[model samples]
Target: MPLALDVLAQVPTRREAVREEYLRRVIPQFTGHSIGEVQWSTAHGDFHWANLAGPDLLVLDWEDWGTAPVGFDAATLYIYALQAPKTAARVRRSLAHILDDPAARVAELLVCAQVLQAADRTSFYATLAEPVRCHLQTLASRSA
Candidate 1:
């Protein structure tokens, strides 16, 4: 995955997987922090289990792959891994370089907002709602 990301990171694109407009509209509603300058990079935008394959780390679904916040992929994977404690821990450990950075907070909140917004629309993320909310609270508090 690191190898793939390293290569993907080098591919240039004017596209933004997650636009500043979207972040401005959704993030502050949850974190109460205004979106400012963000560090952008190429990412697998939808880096979740469904988009990944076993033993060899084959990342599928390139439709959303493009420029995004630096930690977007890690944050998305981490948020989805929340229901499984072990997986969440592994995600944090493996991506500590990105996840531990204070700057990644915005990406985390951006993902949390997406999860919450999806929860509002359907039952797909109902089981994840509370966990995502709790995470949002944690992220918001950190910014305080």
Candidate 2:
């Protein structure tokens, strides 16, 4: 896990206690789940608007593609939604339409997922985001 931790350190700064507490609360939910197994391979890892095409989506940045936990992509999309409120609402609506989980639970899980993603700072905002820093503060407050 040192490699992953190293990757995390490269990203934005957040309160250490908050981040750790968040991880502690969420990690147990997925304990014993296979997280490192690759199930599908895609040509693009980060498929946001920057690389998307009209009507037809194109995957770019293949470097991050690998066998990862299920819903990993969805989590990434949710993070993107956080960065863009309209998109996030749309994503939430879509999830509500299909997912059986309660909205509050889903939201909590999404936060956890975002924290997990942040744990790997190989992306652009890894080193430059204040929101995530605030998130860390929130996590710390919750733990306290």
Candidate 3:
């Protein structure tokens, strides 16, 4: 899907699952105080394959729906796609503009940081840590 900027911009985010407090705390852990108000959007808060279905094409778990940082959905999808590199690459390719954006990159880094922070020591998140760390560093340097 193309960047949902115009549509998402019009929708005010009702923060809950990803509240401003969480973002303020998590984003700095990686970004080192580089905080600025990010572009918010109507996000599919939990945008994973399991939460999706075909034919009608629905996004599930309305409990978490709200305004999120512009690229949050794409970043979350990318994070979920990590086990399948090809799929992750496709996600990157499809949403390159959003993921490559400065504000969106911050959104991504925040997502990655939150993932790495809450990761279990001996689980799927553990496996994702290094790669996420690498990406976080790369994004941080690029932004600088």
Best-matching candidate per TM-score: 1
Instruction: Kindly provide the TM-score of model 3 when superposed on the true structure, using C-alpha atoms.
Output: 0.80
Q: Model 2, 1-144: lDDT tens per residue?
A: 332212332344222212234434454442211122222212123434465555654545555543322233444454555656688668656644222232222333434455445655756555423444454455446435
Question: Across residues 22-111, which tens digit of lDDT does each residue of candidate 3 receive?
Answer: 888887874454678767777767777788787776767767877878788888888767767899899889878778877787568677
- Assess each prediction's global lDDT (C-alpha) against the native: 0.82, 0.41, 0.73
For model 3, where is the 10-residue window of minimal lDDT? 1-10
Give the higher-lDDT candidate: 1 or 3: 1
Error of 2 at 59 (Å): 2.2
To one decimal, what is the Cα RMSD in angstroms of model 2 from the true structure?
12.8
Candidate 2 stretches greater than 4 Å from native: 1-44, 95-144
TM-score of 1: 0.89
Instruction: Give per-residue lDDT, candidate 1, residue 105.
Output: 76
Off by over 4 Å in 3: 1-17, 30-33
